[model samples]
Target: MDILADIATTVLSQLQKPTLAFLLGGMMLAALGSKLEVPTPVYKFVVLLLLLKVGLGAGISIREADLVSLAVPAAAAALTGIAIVLLGSRSLARLRGVSPMDGMATVGLFGAVSASTLAAAMAMLDADGIAYEGFIGALYPFMDIAALVTAILMAKMAQARSRNVIPQNGAATMALGGTGSADNDGPSENRTLVRGILTDTLQSGAISALLLGIAIGVLGRPEAVYASFYEPLFRGLLSILMLVMGMEAWSRLSELRKVAHAYVLYGLSAPLVHGAIGFGLGMIAHQLTGFSAGGIVLLAVMAASSSDISGPPTMRGALPEANPSAYVGASTGLGTPVAILSIPLWIWLADLFIGL
Candidate 1:
């Protein structure tokens, strides 16, 4: 375990940039009108697995020590992240005079944290027995969906302003899968946001593990059920999921270079902004909690500094045709690299101030 952790940490330090390139290459092809073949049977299960992974991941890394001390702080940090990436980014986009579609994409990009980035962090921590692995569960797909819904509302607003099309934010549009908007937040946008998050929560593998945890908590079969049904499956599923996630991220990033130049600002500003929010939330969580270890508490404070994998898919889908792809490329392309440094660095800083 120690050796594996060491390897994972080393990769976090060194191999992440190249890995980003690899992952982005694959995701880009699919996004840019590539018809990638996915087995129909796996799609539904994959969604469930993704959600289940999010929940169990919290269980895996967050000890009873953390749960007792840091749970509320973690929740606060997560909510703050959602607010920043969703609403804050939207305001910034409008100020920049970006189109409705482009603005919505930016909002979603900011709103959603990356799962793949967290996976890298998980590998590093897991390898070392310094198991801060599962906290990345905070960076779920619901973030993307929420932002997508926001983007669509923003698009409707833009249409209304330009062509006077006050498209009702009705149930039919709400039933539509991906509309990006932070304004003109209609009923449909609200409904989809609710549905998406509910889906991510209940339908995901996270819910499955949470159910198992609840069951065990009730039934007193942690060892028996954990080993018998959950452990092996979770480990296997995590490994497979990370590998595929890497591949998909690579594919998505390949097209970023074709977008607008302003995206560079997004790439640069978002991490710094989000990381600061994460640290602040962590500090608040720590001050109020009973977690005794300063180091672990510091790490918890940085909980909102999520995986940066979400940059490409969310942003690429949202940007307007008039915008150069390079900006999106630059932002999405740099996320993994930035996280490699930020997570550990902030953890250290939090310790210096908060630790004994």
Candidate 2:
């Protein structure tokens, strides 16, 4: 009963946050048919700023962090990303109306990190006066890349097996769909596929901005500018981002309905389950490295969030045959909202177990 009461209180507190309030308000406006929208260019620009802010902060923190402290958590994050996709391939992909490739793509998005969501979690923790490792943000790319590579590889292997492509000279030369190369044998084909996925992920707009910011923060002294510009504007810009996301979530609902009921269920539940898995691994990392409760919460947030920006384009290019409505709809329409809302739950759990 005490635990239940704590959860209730945490949720109530979460609902009152301006960040979430803006999100809910946007959803309300969308539901009322207000036809309001943040312009696409503005949204993209806002995302860039947010990513830069997060990356800078993380890079600064990473500069002072001990390599040993970072190792355990980073490894855990990468493992979590791989595990989420593999688990989904077995369970969610096998459900009625969900093809294996489509299922892998959907889970890939879920497994990848959401920059906006990470920013929100950081904001929320700051508001609550929780102290987390600043370097926690550095874990983003590890998890993001791992999930994407694993998903695409698994999806392609499944595709190959399903088609029963015969091996020639002990190696199937059939190129995986998006590689733009057909001359490679089975092993070489896989190497090419992985190399392409890594290149695409690294070169992606979101990741690129983040990596640039991190490099700037690490290699230069931008603390003055960071403190003067990015820090002051973070919350206000985030509110706007949340508002845009809420409206976008509503617009995607119709697309969600076009997919199987299984997708809807997966979207709604995957965040919690995935988050718990992250939280559990975080616990182990905490014990091993004295990782803060707040860092644990952020790690869980990364696991909970579905990729809104990078994962979709990557999936579209890599798994072109997969239906967009299934992966995109399930993620944007349902998974994102649930993940956002689950922040408070994770925070409460982290504090309860680890003493924030």
lDDT of 1 by residue, 1-356 (tens): 96556545644653354333434444555456666554645644653554444445454444443554545654654565466655554554665545556655554555555554454445444443452324435324334444444554455445444653334542323223334344535565556655654454444343344444433333453555445664456545544444455444455366554554455556555666666665666566666764333324223323333333334433344333324344344434544335434555554454456643
- lDDT by residue (31-65, candidate 2, tens digit) is 99998878999999999999999989888888888
- Which residue pairs show backbone clashes in model 2? none
Local distance difference test, each candidate: 0.47, 0.90
- In candidate 1 the C-alpha lDDT for residue 150 amounts to 51
Backbone collisions counted per model: 43, 0
**Best-matching candidate per TM-score:** 2
TM-score of each: 0.57, 0.97
Candidate 1: residue 59 lDDT (0-100): 45
Q: What's the lDDT for candidate 2?
A: 0.90
